[model samples]
Target chain A: MESTANNRVIHVRELVKKFGDFVANDHLNFDVYAGEIFGFLGANGAGKTTAMKILCGLQRPSSGTIEVAGFDVYKQSDQIKKNIGYMSQRFSLYEDLTVKENFQFYGGIYGLSATEIKDRTRQMLESLQMTTSADMILRDIPLGWKQKLAFSVAMVHRPKIVFLDEPTGGVDPITRRQFWEMIYEAASKGVTVFVTTHYMDEAEYCNRISIMVDGRIEALDSPAALKAKYNAATMDEVFIRLARAGVRSMNG
Target chain B: MRIIFYILQKEFRQIFRDKVMLPIIIVIPMIQLFILSYTATFEIKNTRLSIVDQDKSTTSRALISKFSGSSFFTIASYETSYEDGMERIKTGTTDQLLVIGKDTEKKLSRKEEASVLLVTNAINGSAASLMNAYASGIINDFNRFILEDQGPAGAVPALIAVQSRHWYNPKLDYKTFMVPGILVLLVTLIGMFLSGMNIVKEKEKGTIEQINVTPIKKYQFMIGKLLPFWLLALFELMIGLAFARLVFSIPMEGSVVLLLGIASVYLLVVLGLGLLASTVSDTMQQAMFISWFFVVIFILMSGLFTPVESMPAWAQNLNRLNPVAYFIQINRMIMLKGSGFQEVSGLFVALCVYAAAILSIAVKRYKKTA
Candidate 1:
């Protein structure tokens, strides 16, 4: 899709993030349009998390011009934070708290009114078919349910953009598919979704995917286009081909 | 401010929800207060005394009766030989041996100076010194009585008397001294360890990443985190003060309002230390270790168990940085001495400055961005 300034939810340019002498994100550039499911694909240490963290205002870039939800990363990060929701790879909800309490807490911090929080929580629990488990502590629930609940909690405040850092990391395939459906439903409601994952098949669900190799975006295109460009049969083959070639060039 | 309320609500829920932690936070410290107050004492009571009376004179027997009458001593064995009495001390059956030389009455008749020997088990130096002091006091009293009896009753010679009176705690009750200091320690423990561990737990559980990504201000998050424990510490102090009055009968001589006011400022110093520890540590274990290191040093050097003046010069200087030392001093002054704000104002100002400096550094160090 052709993107305009009005439709762009995230704009990153020449973004460079360094840790002392090590460059974790090197001169990156990307733009995410409104309601788009953008996949950030990289190896374990390929700087996708670093870039995502910067976009979410959880970390500052060493030198860059970056904007999230129309707010500058450095100058207006607080504003940016208000307009975005984030779920880390590690579970973030309080395990000792009941499911409903977690919803109230997150929504409350985002300045949602009590009635709004209650209404949203009820609707979310109904849609997730977790109405019966509202009073149950998070630790007692299964991992898949916790992941799904985490995503719903992230959307409790109806953020303009929701950043999911490998939200479906350790779930079964069926649960992962269910999670993607949730993402799709959120996107259909015009919420931009920024996600990072290693699952090649999951990348196919994104509107567009960016592949990072060695702190640099090696490819940015739709999954079909990437497959055609790399002349690979599957996204798995395309990822391996790009990663190996990138490693070879770096070695040489 | 409403956001802070929500954060505080969440923190209180989590704190109260933990089955293991709730009791540990509430009940354990009160139990410690009871145990430590009753057992940790400096007063030497019922010290076992072994006597060897070689002189069977009436004056020597009178001296033996004098020691037996005193409440501080328990006459365990009466041996005829000095070596037998010394054996009682070596065997730990007695704390000290009192040996009276022969011709004790004859020496008095000749107007000669007679000396009684006291040998104490000095293994425990402080206890031994205290035992020696009690024994020497009895001997001196007996000598005075003998002089009075030998001299003309109506024409008694004038002698200078040293009258020593203990102020604040007239009875010299160890509980009275210990309860206030121990109360400071409990409050500091609750403030420092709980606040520090609460934040680092978020880090360990990866929940801090979620909080950091939110729009909550740093000071709001910190206040929310520290306020609950601060209040809890104060509540603990109140409970401790009640126990001091009802159970230990420790006098609350100063104004309760003034004590609480100083306690609130002191809590800021401890809570700020906790926050600083949390900011530097990435796990609950690390935070606990860091807090324990400071707290153990603070409590030991705080003059809770011993007098601060007796410590080495460098240790006394180092205690200037110890928040526990300052609070313990303030607590003792107000609770025991009935000291008002005017008396503790210098220390109070120092605590206020410390609170400001520590809290500012903690807030600055606690970065929302990694």
Candidate 2:
């Protein structure tokens, strides 16, 4: 349980969330270590977003002991916020603002000073090689650039942990590849990355992957180990084997 | 608290960065205050009058002179007959017409009664009634002048004396009543527009999840969200009231600070209702519709346009739930009656209760889908 774990950055135990009578997280338990790309892979409505929401402190668990960055979920949430960055599927950046303005606004909300926002924005824009388009409105930019910019804004405050919910949902394959390169760069700097996606090819990039089905995680292991155990040629086969078996087990 | 300031700074930057919100927040309110204060007045200042003198005699000429000398009526034209005076009224060139009959001198000598005609445009019922009263009173005083010195002791005067005095507003200017009421509407509009769509817009854009993940406490976030609008709403209130004082010449008999203090709570309730509406609506359109619904109801029962006491007893009692009703009472008291805290305490307490209830509903419903 999170109450006992003092080492994990995210410690979720018996994290049950329900909507009316339908359980979204049923006695869920998981822990994420520091500086690892933890992949949360699931089909639609498999509670991946729900579990991520609880970890991020967006939603309260019906009855559970959960902790993020070693702070209790029930209290001391602001401290956790200082250590976290969140980018949801909706691209949590102001579209009307220029790329530079989005960075400044989010940076300011994270308690960065004017100098800090400016300095971080410059370094991040330079790294993205997008210095010339700093003044271009976000809506005018292509989806590929916007996705990358969203990730940079999430990482602006240099939070210890960052959550990306479907961060590369609609980008082209080449852009998605470059997007993972940015994720790798952040991970190499000892920043923990918690990501949710349904992209089977993308799961192999994770240090460890958890495949969830029907409000529960059916399989949690390295992608290679999952493929090997299921005797499958790819992560897609491994996901299908687990998803089908989980559904069968539920009906039986 | 520092974080709240950070959010406010970001919100202001975002507000200014957008093209649509700037005009809605500042420019529109100022324009409304100016136009409403100057135009939406009850005290009739400029009136149009036409005189039809049938006699053209000294007595009729003297009476015509009295009409021209009066401040309320401007001598629009000279009419030779009553039919010509009616033409002036029909053409909309004159608001009112006065007809003096041909036998004015003979009637006074024989001591027989004489008649005068007053025609007013009845479209704007309040202004027309007031103009009619003012014209009749002035004419009656002129008829009494002719009778006091020249007529027989027992002769009946052609006009009746109706000595009247204005109570609160001695000048009876339309601007005096309108200025304070417009101030109430301005504060309500500012409060409703800002808080009404903020949370829902955040949700639609998915920033609610971004904020949710942070250790931002619910009450802390609520205070941060509502306070900017509360202060902004107060700023709007001050602007509207200042315009009322300067442009409309409406005097505040009550303490400004006390009025501001009570008004702040009413702003909170209005803003909280907007936040509560945001919680229920997922889209800007839905939020807008919900906010407008309550706005219409509050304005109808607000007592800014009509007298609350004149409404049915049940309707009057139902008005107690409306924050605008309380605000209207406080505004009129401070701007008109000039009363202090003791006079407005009942409304103040009611607004506080409404604020608490509305804020709680908003906080309880402010949840991201887990």
Candidate 3:
């Protein structure tokens, strides 16, 4: 198929990452279009984090032609960083800071003016119905609220892409649903969502999903397409089918 | 510049929010200054003396009385036999023993030379020299007393009466000498350990992952990491100097501004060392251990408790690179000797060079990309 480079926010060609003799990403090829919820599905040790880090400008790729937001990873990582937001399973909000303060800090570091940070912080607190908890320390907030606050803070700069590395790993189903709704809202606003999750049910929420097995992309298609291709009834079955055929352990 | 200010704001907030750390950073060092100054002394008091006078004459008794009257010596015993005086010294009951030979008064009356034997415990060599000097001073006083009693007409002038004037600290107060050194230590510890552990704490908690992904420059991050502790260390120095003046009555011989200016550069060296430690270790424990290893070395060799002049030549040469040593030396010179900027400029320049080297190394080692 002919590729549409203008529509793609992320382009990875012949991507390879290695740690010593171990290959974490083996010559992967993919493209993620703008404003799409792209699910990067993998078991533990399937090089999910290594690839995410490379894309986030937090790790160097051993060898690859990877571009995010139209900036080369090797030469223009600073530009790439300026145009991306990141949230992780281990939340990045400072526990010592108030909810409003956390928003202000992230906004300030992202090069927002003081007046802009002040305005955005107030708007964020009001929108989340967290005006009452704005002054409350993050450590005192409920975990679900903290996760939501972390997501909002990560998006404070409104970058073109947001990388979510298992962003809802330990949340209840209701909170996870709420978090996915936030992702969808962001995606609707022309923000590309690149997320990784262990939940097969959550994987079904993506527009396109790629399953990696043993440092290589084993399948790439929509949830229904992948299920049909694997002759399976559920994403779990599809995942299990591919995972069992792999040699790398979940602990790798 | 703006990004670095954000980091500084975050660090200051976190530091002040920690209730346990606030007191540890400010109060503990003040308490240490008060307690350690009084106890860290070199003054030797109450040297126990034993004397065996074989001559049993009035002259011998007068000489013995002189030793007993002196405040430096406490006459432990007046043993008649030499063996008893020797036994007292061997048992460590007496620090020194004086033995006056037979017919000491008869020899003086005949204008012949007289002799006395002085023995001291040389285990502590410095204290032993002091004890020997005190003993000889007492015996010389007795010789003058005898000559005056024999009706001499303002006899021959004595050999070289050295008029010694101790400048600055005329009283030779060890507290005056030690207070400034301890202040350097407090500042160095606060600057090094706090900043060192701060970065590693973020690393251990995985907060650095988000920070690493940010567009902030490396120098901006390092400046943000260092500024709070650098300011805090200077504040701690102020408290230390205040205590030195009010509590110890340590006179501020030089300009407080000059002292603080030098201390500010010294803080860079210490805080830079902390940043260096953080870059080498991934965990707070590892960072603490690494910083502690160097802190202990710097403190011991800082000329705080012992004179740097007395240390072996190689150790002293190695001390040229030690920031603590330079700070301690500069602090004492300024506080005790009333030294001017011109006097401390060499050390000040050395510290600036050292700080620049270490901080640049730390910034270089700190990886934005994992």
- The C-alpha RMSD in Å for every predicted model, in order, reads 2.6, 5.8, 2.9
Question: Which sections of candidate 2 miss by over 4 Å?
Answer: A1-14, A27-29, A64-67, A70-79, A98-101, A112-119, A132-136, A241-252, B34-151, B155-162, B252-262, B337-370
Candidate 2 on A1-252: residue-level lDDT in tens?
Answer: 122344478887888999999888778778888888999987777888888877777777789989888888778667878899888888777777788878876776677888998999999999999999999988899999899998998898899999999999999999999999999999899888999987999999998889888889888888999998989999999988778755423342
TM-score of chain A of 3: 0.96
The TM-score of predicted model 1 comes to 0.94
Evaluate candidate 1 and give its CAPRI docking class based on DockQ. high
**Candidate 3: Cα lDDT at B274:** 91
The lDDT of each candidate is: 0.91, 0.82, 0.90
Candidate 3: tens digits of C-alpha lDDT, residues B1-370: 8888889889989999999999899899999999889888877668998989899998888888888888998989889888999899899999998999999989988978899999999999988988888888878878777766775666755556678898978998889888999999899889999999999999887888888888988888888888999999999999899989998899999999999999988898899899889989999999999999999999999889878899999999999989999999999899988999999999999999998898788888889986
Report fnat for all candidates as fractions from 0 to 1: 0.90, 0.61, 0.71
Segments in model 1 whose C-alpha atoms lie over 4 Å from true places: A245-252, B56-58, B76-94, B154-156
The better candidate by lDDT, 1 or 3, is 1
- Least well predicted 10-residue stretch by lDDT in candidate 1 chain A: A243-252
1 or 3, which is superior by TM-score? 1
Q: Which candidate number has the best TM-score?
A: 1
- lDDT-wise, the better of 1 and 2 is 1
Greater DockQ among 1 and 2 belongs to: 1
Clashing pairs in 1: none
After TM-score superposition, the amount by which residue A202's alpha carbon in candidate 3 deviates from its true location, in angstroms, is 1.3
